[model samples]
Target: MRVLVIGTSGYVGSAVAQRLSAAGHQVVALIRPDRGKRARRYEWRIGDLTDPDSLTAAVTGDIDAVIHAGTPTGDATVDATAVAALTSRLRGTGRTFVYTSGVWVLGATGTATADENSPVNPIPIVGCRPDIESQVLDFAGVGIRTAVIRPGIVHGHGGGIPALLVDLARKHGAPVVVANASVRWPMVHVDDLAALFGVVIEQAPAGTIWHGVSENAVPVRELAIAAGQAAGVGGEPQVWPLSQAQAELGASFADALALDQSVSGHAARDRLGWRTEHPDAVPDLREGSYR
Candidate 1:
């Protein structure tokens, strides 16, 4: 399949593009002009998602599918505008469009594990996503094969959400959390999540929703210990009051971090045979690249 992957320079995008290429797909990376010196590995197309013209041009010509993994810049309008533009271009095109959402959209699931059918109660930062996801899914009825992927906390290679804890561990000799230490975070390896993109692009039907989570849930305190140990801190995790966390990391992110969630990816595993090779995230965070 000929695939167009946006956000090629980002952590998730780079991994997804590489995995698709390794899987023998003709991967075209849509990169920003400022991040020059294009990678020679895949066919590179320069464009910005926020720019309607660039998004239209990027979707034009011949392309089998598009993976919209690019992240928002904290401005919901910019993200919504991009989705509107992309949906407009792909409407009635009979092409595959994979949109990236996150498990945070399910909000605090408490003890219950969220599934594909779970209701979305997004946090403040991603509050705009439910509406945008609806808009993208609407294209499925208009001849576009649209799929929404809700990934859990993506952790690997000492990057992603774990990096925040690791950085704090290095600075303060312990990992930190907001308000409560028992909040649960669902996690997925970057490589495993990338593989799901390949499966959905090739086999998913229109309006499919896939959760790219491996571990159903892990406590913030446990992750903090792992992060601190990996960073050579090896101490009890520190707690930040919600107000302090909000002041430091912004209310949206702080509230998101405090959410207790457990999510299942059984649909992806059963439907597409996605088996996570790196499921034990604590060990990885403590001894692997993050160490």
Candidate 2:
């Protein structure tokens, strides 16, 4: 299968590209040709989003599936334009089109573990994801195999979100919140999340929604302590209140930190048969990779 994966350079993309390659799939990673020194399995192409013609060469000929892993920045129009253009270019091709969405879209789920079928309550940063997903999923009805992968806090070697917690734990002089941390959040290793992509490309039906997560819900404060221990700051885990955490980390972060966003991945595991090799998020923190 000739698989075309966009943005195969970053943390999640790198891991996913590697896994797809190792699994014996022919991968063509849309990359800047200038990055010749970096090791990768896919063919690099120089293309601009504004000029769809540039990507015509990349998308044309014989391409089986397109995994849109490219992440856009602050501008909504730019991201929407890229999605629109790419969708237009690949329409009616009967190829798999996978989009990467995040768990933040589910927002605060209180204590109950929600699934792919659960309602989405997005945060400020990713609020537009659902609308974008709607456009992609619409293609499924047109003979295109469209799907979305919603991942949780994707922690891995290069210091992602877990690093933020470890930093807060190590730098904060005040007592951290370790009791009644009430927020429930889901987590997954980068590799485990990458495995889900293969599942989507090969097995998922068109318009399918998958939770690219392993553990659905873990207490917020407990996750912080695990981060503290991993950051080499273990001393009878401090039990600070939400107000206290707010005072130390600021209210915006405090609010986000306090979110109990737990969602179930039973659907993904049942369908993809994914097993997380690095199940513990805190241990990844202690390895100091977060540093």
Candidate 3:
């Protein structure tokens, strides 16, 4: 398969690129010219989706699958515009287009071990989700294999939000966790998430919605303590109201930190034969090592 990965140089895209290439697929990474020289064995195409010509060049035929991982900033409408352009061009091509959405779109609901069918709680940022997923899924209706992957808080090695928190812990000497870290956030390993992307593109039903999560949910406080331990920082988590978290970390990031979102990965496992290698998300944080 000739896979053209949009935004293929970032964290998740890079991981997915490695996964597909290791599986014996030829990978074409569509990256910004700024990523400098390309890595070995992979083909590189310099382009930005903001420009139609560049985007077309990125996805021109001979591309068998597309991992739509690029998220343009500045406007929600612009994000939709980017997705619409790619889906419009790729419709009926029999190519698989994988769209990455976050589990945050399910919003805040008491954990019922929600799966792909959970009701969505709309945050301002995630409001674009339904529209975006709908557009991609519509491609399946037009004969393209379109799949949407709703990823949880992914962590592994230098990736994951927890590791990023470790960076913050190192800088601030102690991390301030919102509401005592008990707010459940779903999480997965970066490689596991990338593997699920491979599964979806290859096996998921055309209109299926997949989840890239391993554990059902881990408490935020537990996650915080682990990050602190990994960073060799020590301090009891500072409990604060949601308002305080918003004030401390910008409100958008605060919503993520404070959201008690638990999502189920059962559907992906059952339907796509996607199994997560890492069953636990806290061991690395708990012991200060990802090994």
Candidate 4:
């Protein structure tokens, strides 16, 4: 399969493009015109998500599938338009289209675990994402093999949000938790999430949604402590009041970090044989990548 992948310059998309190439698929990475022409294992095509013409031009007929793992442009209309432009070119071609969304769309799940079928209560940080998801899934009806993957807080390779905890610990002499000590987040290692993307691209039924979480609910306080260990700091993590965090990190993003959610990815495991090689994120933060 000749797969055209957007966002290859990003963390998740880079991992995904590598996995697809290793699995014997030809990967054509869509990148910005201004990006350096560094040699990569996969093919490169000039494009940008904000520019619909570039997106349309990049999806030539030889491409068998597309995985949209790009960061949103922060404008709902532009993002939606980008999706439309990409999918419109693939309409009636029976090519696959996979959109990357995040678990934050489920918002605060409290005690009960949310699944792919759970109703979405998105936080403000992901405003209009659910609507965009709906738009992508609707393409399945028009002969496009469209699917959506909602990944958990992605961590690994010494990057992502966990690195922030380590940075904060090094700066403040202690780790910091955004809200109360008990707030939780679902998580997935970047490589493991990439494997799931490969599976969905090859075998998912049209219009299906999958949760790419490995651990359903990891306590943020514990993660902060682990981050502190990685940073050579000691004692419990300091709690940053939500208001204070919002003032620094912006209200919507801070509120998202404080949300307590437990999301299950068992559907992918049971149905697609997607096993998570890295089961615990705490160790990765304390002794693995973040260290």
Residue 141 in model 3: lDDT = 85
* The best candidate in terms of lDDT: 4
Report the CA-based lDDT of candidate 4 relative to the real structure.
0.92
Where does the lowest 10-residue lDDT sum fall in candidate 1? 32-41
Question: On a 0 to 100 scale, what is the lDDT of residue 16 in model 2?
Answer: 85
| Pairs with steric clashes in candidate 2 | 183-260, 184-260, 184-261, 230-286
Q: State each model's C-alpha RMSD to the native.
A: 1.5, 3.4, 2.1, 1.0
Model 3, span 104-220: residue lDDT tens: 888886847888887777676677787778888888889888999988888876665777677766766775577546788888888898899888877888988988888878887
TM-score of each: 0.95, 0.85, 0.92, 0.98
By lDDT: ranked, best first? 4, 1, 3, 2
lDDT of 1 by residue, 7-42 (tens): 877899999999999999998888777878655678
Stretches of candidate 3 exceeding 4 Å from the true structure: 34-41, 288-291
Candidate lDDT values, in order: 0.87, 0.73, 0.77, 0.92
For candidate 3, the TM-score is 0.92
Report how far residue 274 has shifted in candidate 3, in Å: 0.7
The residue ranges of model 4 lying beyond 4 angstroms of the native Cα positions read: 36-38
Please state the error at residue 24 of candidate 4 in Å: 0.9
lDDT of 4 by residue, 20-51 (tens): 99999999999887887888767899888889
* Model 4 lowest lDDT segment of ten: 33-42
Clashes of 1: 0
